[model samples]
Target: MSLIRSLRLDPLPVVTTARVELRPPIASDYEQWATLRGESRDFLTPWEPTWPGDDLTRNAFRHRLRRYAREAREDIGYTLFLFGRADGALLGGVTLSGVRRGVTQSCALGYWMGQRHAGRGLMTEAVRGIAVHVFETMRLHRMEAACLPSNEASKAVLRKAGFSEEGLARQYLRINGQWRDHLLFAMLASDPRPRA
Candidate 1:
């Protein structure tokens, strides 16, 4: 028999915070997601990678769901959509990718907030809630995030979520078709949780 055991999150996950709920995206979310992304295109494009021509289409969403499912099945990543708890509005998304096991026991974090929800502190709450699931439930050691030096709002969110700025990376990622430098940050499981 093989020694490897499955790490599949069979039922997926739904994480709740004070103001938001984080859950996996579903087929029914395509309309809301596409509308929100379409409206926020200008506001988000500067900080995000270039989008494909058909990125907002239902077919693209189906492909995205397929990829997410494969990642979850292989225990490589988790992607959750953030929604307003009271109104059930889709506000943004968070992804924990590049999940490393064995000696590393870590993952990379990425998030995006809709234009309407920017500066609301909801993303911070979602990040903290996901951190709890990552460290306590998934038993991971560290979560790392990197953002452009000019993204002050993102930096603030990470800081409020208890991540400590580590250093700078040269051309860490491609944003808006350009390779950009990024400020790195990390939060350890052993670190004390930030109080609200």
Candidate 2:
């Protein structure tokens, strides 16, 4: 993409809440992102996609930027970095992916928080911001989140963000070392919105 095109396609602007900021990851984030993953390898390995040995390389971050920019231009996946507004520290990220419009305007939600950031209700608040953007701003009718049946933390975030447990999906996705079943949760436009 040309510089002008890239500028025009700048990932969606920052989304902020009283305690958090959802922004796109920049090149400068490489170091901290690398360090975070390095230290949290054990903490995140079970739930995350398989990470290759080279995933932390600088070039990997470059590829991620390109993917984020492309996804933004296509309105497919707007991945945002989560931050603690009080100190502007990187908390983790939230994403609205698989966006589908027309007769059914809907998408899926996925997120992760740094180890230290878990259980703090930060991801819950961030999910609320994401819900508002996808449902109200983008006019999407439904937003879905499914997590491994064992992920109580994620289930709590989904429920706290106003999604109701829909059911279980077998082999919903592959994570870490194998295919995993997920518990489906969804928040339709008709569902009560979480207080932001």
Candidate 3:
């Protein structure tokens, strides 16, 4: 595969809520993305994978964009950045990944909010909007999410967005440099949207 590939669809669909907009990040967004992630570093580190030495660099961001585009084109995943509708500030990101098709049409949800935007209800709104896209627009059967057992806020957000706790996964993922247990949550296409 080449570093650059053309996407069949021109201009990715933009998801909007009352307070925010979700869209794929483009090249020009590098600076704002870097700044937002930098400011929220300490607040976000615990729930995320360990940052690389050059995690904040432009080159790394370029690599991320390429991967996001490639996966989206291959119909396996989607990643969107959340921006404040009022001021266009970079707020955070939401992704539906690990997609499986055929017999099981499903994907996993992962999201994060900037420290300043925490507890504002924006992330919840984004999740609901994206869930609609996943089930209705993308026609996937189910969406799943996993979070650290200690993450009460995340657990609540998932519930508010219509995901029911499924079970626990022991040492599910490596987070902040350690393997951690995570509680699983899922929503199916037949599940009614909580905010609908």
Q: For each candidate, what TM-score against the reference?
A: 0.96, 0.92, 0.94
Worst 10 residues of 2 by lDDT: 2-11
Clashing pairs in 2: none
Ten consecutive residues with minimal summed lDDT in candidate 3?
1-10
Model 1 ranges with Cα > 4 A deviation:
1-10
Candidate numbers sorted by TM-score from highest down: 1, 3, 2
Question: Model 1: per-residue lDDT, tens digit, 1-196?
Answer: 1223263335677899989999999999999999999999999999999999999999999999999987877778989999999999999999999999899999999999999999889999999999999998889999999999999999999999999999999999999999999999999999998975
CA lDDT of each candidate?
0.93, 0.86, 0.90
Model 3, position 102: C-alpha lDDT score:
96
> Which residue pairs collide, candidate 1?
none
Q: Is candidate 1 or candidate 2 better by TM-score?
A: 1
The runs of at least 3 residues in candidate 3 whose Cα sits more than 4 Å from the true structure, single-residue gaps closed, are: 1-11
TM-score of 1: 0.96
Query: What TM-score number comes out for model 3?
Result: 0.94
Global Cα lDDT for candidate 3? 0.90
Poorest 10 consecutive residues by lDDT, candidate 1: 1-10
Q: Write the per-residue lDDT of candidate 3 for residues 1-196, one digit (tens) a residue.
A: 3333453553565899888899998999999899989999999999999999999999999999999987888777789999999999999999888989899999999999989999988999999889888887788999999999999889989999999999999999999999999999999999989863
Q: Runs in model 2 with CA error above 4 Å?
A: 1-11
